[model samples]
Target chain A: MPERSRAHEWTPITLLPLNGGPDPARLADSFLTPTSRFFVRNHGTIPIVDPDAFRLEISGMVRQPLRLSLDELTQRFPTVRRPALIQCAGFRRSELARVRAIPGELPWDEEPVSTAEWGGIRLADLLAAAMPDDAARHVAFEGCDDVEREGRRFGFGGSVTMEEAARHDVILAFEMNGEPLTAEHGWPLRAVVPNVIGARSVKWLTRIELRPTASENYFQRRAYKLVDRAGATTDAWEAAPAISTLPINTLICRPRGGERLCPGPIRLAGYAWSGEPGGVAAVEFSVRGGAGWRPARLSEINLPGCWREWTAEVDLASGRHDLLVRALLPDGSAQPADPAPLWNARGYMNNSWARAVLEVRAD
Target chain B: MPERSRAHEWTPITLLPLNGGPDPARLADSFLTPTSRFFVRNHGTIPIVDPDAFRLEISGMVRQPLRLSLDELTQRFPTVRRPALIQCAGFRRSELARVRAIPGELPWDEEPVSTAEWGGIRLADLLAAAMPDDAARHVAFEGCDDVEREGRRFGFGGSVTMEEAARHDVILAFEMNGEPLTAEHGWPLRAVVPNVIGARSVKWLTRIELRPTASENYFQRRAYKLVDRAGATTDAWEAAPAISTLPINTLICRPRGGERLCPGPIRLAGYAWSGEPGGVAAVEFSVRGGAGWRPARLSEINLPGCWREWTAEVDLASGRHDLLVRALLPDGSAQPADPAPLWNARGYMNNSWARAVLEVRAD
Candidate 1:
């Protein structure tokens, strides 16, 4: 809520129940992430609303159930803009809670991802003027934030999958990085959905229904699926997978996890994506952890669901190492070399092979 | 130029015959500044033009000189935006070139200031359609690139005082913080001028003229001015003065100087300003070097030539220290507790009293 520290000073951030994120070595300094060093996941606890009395309702399986108002949803739709990359299906839940304890949530390292440019209109143009029907097949959303947990009161919900709300890069954002939308982001609306998983991009938004399934809420059926343990029940959290797009990753934002290297060359860099008919293709790097890798260079921005900005230079020596990083997917899948058999239980997508360490020494 | 490093890792920037800047501990991490960590400064090179054949011109003492283009200066005037804070009268010229040896130049350090938003068009609505001439006092501007130095071939120029170019917060910029202008900034025009001296904000802009007495080019009559030594003569730089606005400074941007601290309650933050009707008004802080200081808080924006955001907490205990900081101004003037008595001869405004150092240890 403001107590959130670590915007970068050799990374390592943790702060608040607000879910602090970032420290993929300060996300390798830039490819856009500066909304105060972006990364603050939040679930409930942050609702003040009132941007001239907000509004937005839209009712379920609609044929006509609107509500509107934030100046009639920004002067009747039509705005659009993109830039994507959202991240945060617990992006690296602290490397799966250091491989053991996933306890009461909040671990997420690698700054819950960023990349902005949003702007709004087009949740399929407000579900095509609220005529949705044909028995809607999922689109929920919610969020005026409530959060109570084992004591009842809820709010932050989610859904999607009506072909991911008729993608065209989803949207509903009310601008970000072109301003207008700051009340801890979601000043007038918020649901961007690009590349998915940033908890379905909801935030202060007030409902949106049109469903026929997939919104048994509790964070669209038990906190972003992919279960295996941590108190599951409810039929193994509705048979696993509910984490929309975002998968083939890559990160290592510079030699920054406790960095202290010396022995020559280095440089490295970070970012890399995927999510949607396979996106990022090739990002490799190793330094020993994977035994042999190399090949970085990327940056001609691959787009489709964003992220890409790599680099290389290698050549070290002196001692302590680790390093890693991975990614390749354009359907070629890659990125696995061990996340301890993809854990889960609530730590969500820990991606795997991203490592860091360093130490070198011996000028 | 992509080879420049340390944009962060606890500040200390310096790179480029292209001038980089930023390490007033990363300019206290935000209150605008970030066009890739702002603070560039370049006086030569980086000018490729073609924002669809930009133009500008306007000509001296006008009656109707004109030229315009860039879509007739955005459909003839009216844009405006503002935010300001430009800095760099060689911001702390590397602590007055480590107190002596000024030599050729570039030692910069303390990141030549930033702050943005800009946007454009109101050079008093293009000097009210190029009418000017009632013995127009001083305007000048220039730019289109060039820059050779110890062998001649110049270009970047400057001037002002047509009552600081008809105030209303100067302008002429063509957007920044909202895109449009990046060939390392200065794409289709530049000249924001607010609170002056950023080499008079004259980027790739080409000509504006008017003048009557100040700007005989060569960096407006023998480079930036101020006087007191380091290779003076041109009649002591035409008898001193020409360094426009900016003065009551203050920096520090969080612990960062040789940081290493451990002792206890540190915090401290940074940024402070004052240019025009002497703005800032209070910022203090110290830790031995200045004897006893304290008071910091600030940040309700204040605005005058901008900057603000301040903080403080202190406490310490173990070894090495230093710290400092300063400011106060709204006419109370304060800030020179020693930058070695404000050096000069091209190390322009150092302002002094900022310090840093740190190093505690002992957990």
Candidate 2:
């Protein structure tokens, strides 16, 4: 196991942890997470590395394999900065736990995600220099941390197809919010594959390999795979494709669950996101179980690969109300109205409509 | 003059000094400015105050004239947290500099504004405890920072109607972003009146008084006024009313001035805000100089009293494109199409449509 290190530590808040489902009650008026309040998700022990000695290796099917130091990586390539969102694939996995009472890993509440301005060199630029052959189909990433789960030992590893990795959006991010990466996050270096599952964007990244075959690591093959329960058959994990782009999803960030609102025009606010390159196309909200849908006013600020905020004003006539928020992707994809449809064995990628309950008072 | 602090002290990017108009090319990606990057517009010097020694005096027409230290204030009332956007009445004032080139005052770039999560005691709760009579018309706020500008010595002061101050949105904020307020950003305490001009939400707030009349301070009476240039006028400052709620406005933040993009799908992002209680209703973008307007995707997240972010995706054929963004308030009020229609002598309150240019290449 990698030596555990505390890179970035923040004071904790006293709010109750909502299951893996997002608690709309915790969102503040500003869309950005306050530094101390940001959620954390770690697959393995955080690694401590000396920045001066840190090196990133680009190997595998490249004509010229290269091991470049941190200084050389930044100094040699043109630096680019952009805002991106990094979200755990099982962000609300705990919600599945409540539905089936099934056991799973990472008992996360509504935290485990964050967005920031990441500065780094483009991975496409780096790969261009190494010149991988056309036959290379996937780019695999390996982090320094090691994990032991249920008598199985494995290093943190994942892979993305080379086509997605070569897109201009991917980067070898080394800095968050203008400073070097914090330890809790992958310090020194990390893979930032925009609009992809957070698991594939390995932190504490040490190696990048261009391979004709996809990664056969446990994380890639066994853990993150989705299976069919009705078929009553066990298929090899390799048969399943790796989760890439996120689906259209929304989470109510205010009025939280089990909260009350004064009877009047109450502002309903939440965040919506999609991994499709076209961005969020639309968001419709309903206070009455999708009986009537009203278009929400979407935030104008677009931070690349980050979630977009949206809000709607609904008048509650002194009663119990169920507020639901669902988003549409640029490709016309909308979140499933119910979570039960997407429930799986591992509790992964649950992109369902987010609902909240608010008791409204006339006074 | 108050201490003339150098602008952009902590930022890596060199901000172009405020001129008469926005360059159209210098837009940033995120809507909120980093604290170090936020533009400062001071009519007086920043008052340095020791937090331990700070006291807020609440007197005038109230039955009880209360003097409370910062600690006493926190302990005495239930703390409330809200996100608010504080905009200078003169934000984007330089846009007025384009048409008439008005003289005097700092040449503010389009900035002169910011938003933050403020934690403090509710003004409504405090005013209720003070037992003010119904006869009170206005509640005035005074800041500790005194200023000498244009041969006049004045303290930053403003007033809101008694009914407005009694609303739940007004707060005497002592903390910003989960930390005690920074020295430069009115440490110890400040007043936050959502949707109002920044002038009314007095920073370095020291005193609150109930009055039968409005505040007659120079900032309230002479400056921050809107004028009708088309009509006959005597003194340029006399005909205008004190600036209050901001009009519906939008700003494009990315593909910053002079940035290039390849011909394909170009994603445009920006922020929109209004001073009224209702959120922004809609945002429309155009790439052909208002020839055709398309609705941009708005973020679902809406923090109370905070700016809303919006985004749009456009497929651009290879060439130079002029992009324009306009916002509409919840009341269906849209910003004027051009600054020419909204120009005033003092160069204040320019809420014209924001525009930008991008050159797309085939590569």
Fnat per candidate, as a fraction, reads 0.00, 0.00
Across residues B1-363, which tens digit of lDDT does each residue of candidate 1 receive?
A: 111222332332433436765566665644656566677777777667766667888888889998877787887664545457788788878787777768777877777787766677778778878999899899888888887876987778888888888876688876675556566567667898877678888988878888678888878677777777776678778767687888778888788878788898889888888675757878888788888887887653455566777887877889888888898876766888877677776788888678888988876
**lDDT string, candidate 2, A261-348, tens digits:** 6778888777788888767878998888778888997764444577887878887898888788889877777888877878776777
* Strongest candidate by TM-score: 2
What is model 2's C-alpha RMSD?
24.7
In order of listing, the candidates' clash counts read 6, 29
TM-scores (chain A) of the candidates: 0.35, 0.89
lDDT of 2 at B233: 51
